[model samples]
Target: MATQNPPVADIETAQISSQTAQAGSTTGSWANGAFQKLKSNLVFRSKWAELNGAMGDLGTFIPIILALTLARDLNLGTTLIFVGIYNFITGAIYGVPMPVQPMKSIAAEALSDTNFGVPEIMAAGILTGGILLVLGVTGLMQLAYRLIPLSVVRGIQLAQGLSFALTAVKYVKQKQNLPKSKALGDRPWFGLDGLVLAIVCLCFIVIVNGAGENLRRGCGAAREGSDQRDEDGDVEGRKSKTARVRKIIFSLPSAFIIFVLGVVLAFIRRPKVVHEIKFGPSSMEVVKISRHQWKRGFIKGTIPQLPLSILNSVIAVVKLSSDLFPGKEFTATSLSVTVGLMNLVGTWFGAMPCCHGAGGLAGQYKFGGRSGACVALLGVAKFVLGLVLGSSLAHILNQFPVGLLGVLLLFAGIELAMAARDMNTLEDAFVTLMVTAISLVGSSAALGFLCGMIIFVILSLRGWTKDKPFSTIWTDRSTPEQP
Candidate 1:
């Protein structure tokens, strides 16, 4: 037996080979697991879902981009490219359709103030980004979140929704023709085809969303009934699948269809507008800044945006992400980091100021995006368009019906406002409504936040001895468990 045994050297070589093979197998498995996560996060075959998600920010994106480029002389190339790249990165990292939108306060200020130029815009973005980075790294976001009452945050959201709804209504009316006596300028009486089309689109959205909800409820009821019978599992599963498919088909591309229909209608009805478009490479130049410009930008651009950014971009985004994608936790700190990073990097290259908006998230979720694949797809589209169609975008968008765009905004606003309904108690609702009214009337998030804080302090002092302490208002610890 000893003579038959393999030599020691041969035995050692065999052992080494076996070990190598085992190690290779392990490495391969690890690589595969990582690749699978990437695939799941970034890739999907659902074209409709991707398109729908892309449509979510069109309302905000279109108006802001156009206003910046046309009205403020902002560089379209830089804005689109930076935004597209940032969106792609965000999608890959977050695995959700978390949107990157312009800071509305800055945008409004920049658009309104003729003196605010590239330098001011850049300063504002850089300063905001720096502040956000500091907040994120220092964990101040959580501290801030803990300091603010949930009702105050809810009120900001409610006010933003109402404002957007009003804007949508205005857009619809903008397209409508008025009587000769009531007409503003050269407007004709009782005729504007886009308004009719927009009405149809709105009706379609309502019907589809309503039907999808009804179908889901019916399936849920059926499942409840099936729980009594052991063999009904398969039948229930089949029914669920059917309902899901129907819902997806109906609800997923509703906004996109409306948008595309608008474009098509525009082209058919107004080919001249399309013909005027000039397709060419976009011309962009670097932005220059001064100390004085930086100072003004910091005050007007950065300060006004701080409250909204903290509440909507950081706090509301975290809440919405938690609600829509349970177990996929997002934090105020992480959001701040991204927002800061994007602005810091983007401002250097002449990009528009950007942030993660709660409204954009609501809009995306209202569509069929459960995964980042939706935004990833959107990113790809954005990059391609920015590179290939940047110059012609203005003309193309000009042809697109504004009223239809309004319909999209209308729904997104509704979804965002609906999130406020989570505040159940009457006292909370009253505080939120007060904040909403103040925000709407004052047109200021900072003002709304201040008013809410003051109201909360008064309420706390009035009932300081209650079993539910005033401090509970600031802490989410007592929040009723959400399903």
Candidate 2:
């Protein structure tokens, strides 16, 4: 009897041959299987990895950065609770798992303009959330999407990224004790401490990447050799080796090592740190609001926030739709409606205002947030955190050094900056850069967005005027028509 190839093998072979012919690259089922397994492990089983990765992404970084920046202005206790709540809601709606804290731009404005106390703000948040819920239920959120233009929306996001990067640098400078140094008549450069921190963080990132690469190479080598032995023996041996290696690596507790090193370095240097960094409260404290106070404050606070929240939602949808669904007829109205509803539901349970967070949603998609289920997982994590340890979360976040936060944020900003470069035209790129610059200079994301929009409008109007029928009379006959 002639030996025949198994049906599965035949199908796989055909697929591989087709792909190889089309792309000049060979792929095997074994490799696909390994990748699928690794992906599954990273997403489903590895909570720490998921958390860290989410936090490291722009979505988490933006809120955390904001939190750190506005630490002095806002109540640490209230902010922590707000973050947990916000994260829970955004994670659910956007299908991106990450914490959303107080937006520094909004917080600063609130601090300056709103006389409402922390309790009142919390109440207002509750009301704003209710409004969102009503809008969502009524399906009005979708309508909001139609109102905003993609260019303006993205202009704001790009501006936000610039703002974040500039703020990170500022924070780093402050922490490093770098001065304007006008007295010395020397051009400003990185302070001694800032330079040291930057070098250390860079080294840490490089080391981590190197270690990961080495592990991957080792795994590949082991896989290549596994077929030499009896099929079953080879598989079992390979599995054992993989498990052992993974176990050793995972059990090493690298975070502990970094912490130890930091402690040791601090003790040895005893250098006078320029800025006093406060991470969070020493302990979690839950302050209960009376029913009367909650009711009165909620009404007073929420009414003002509704417009801002709506504006935020509209801006977010426009930007997201532009990049994710470019050239497609994305209904801004529909997105706004969806987000509005999500916000309403989220706020009822003490969540923060839910809008389309540019960084979180974008980062989640970048990190493989493909479906609602993935976003649901993020929501679940946030919900759990909020319900179980809302207050204490602040304290935990506070423990991270400003330098580390700055480094993480800097990386996130760089990622956004790179993404901005994908714009099709120089005009768009200029708009993005200019918006970012204004936002950073003013130290306000919202204001930066407003300025960018103003510029966009002015340019758009100019283009319209030039395109008018009468303008043709003044143009040279030899000049080609403008697109």
Whole-model lDDT, model 2? 0.47
Query: For each candidate, C-alpha RMSD in Å?
Result: 8.2, 14.6
lDDT, model 2, position 252: 35
Best by lDDT: 1
Candidate 2 ranges beyond 4 A from true positions: 1-51, 57-99, 110-116, 130-144, 176-195, 206-314, 321-356, 362-396, 430-434, 437-483
Look at candidate 1 and give me any clashing residue pairs. Answer: none
User: Tens-digit lDDT track for model 2 on 1-483?
Assistant: 999867998899999989877664334666676666445423432333343344444324433433432442334333334444444444344333332434333343344444444444445555555666566556576555555445555555666556556656655444422111112232233532344665576466434323332222221122222333324665554556654554444333222243344444543444332134343333334434567756655555555445445544444644553665354333445444554454444334333343555555444433333333344454455445545544444433343344544555654454444446556776677677776677567755556567777877777776766645555645656578789
Q: What TM-score, computed on C-alpha atoms, does each candidate reach?
A: 0.80, 0.55
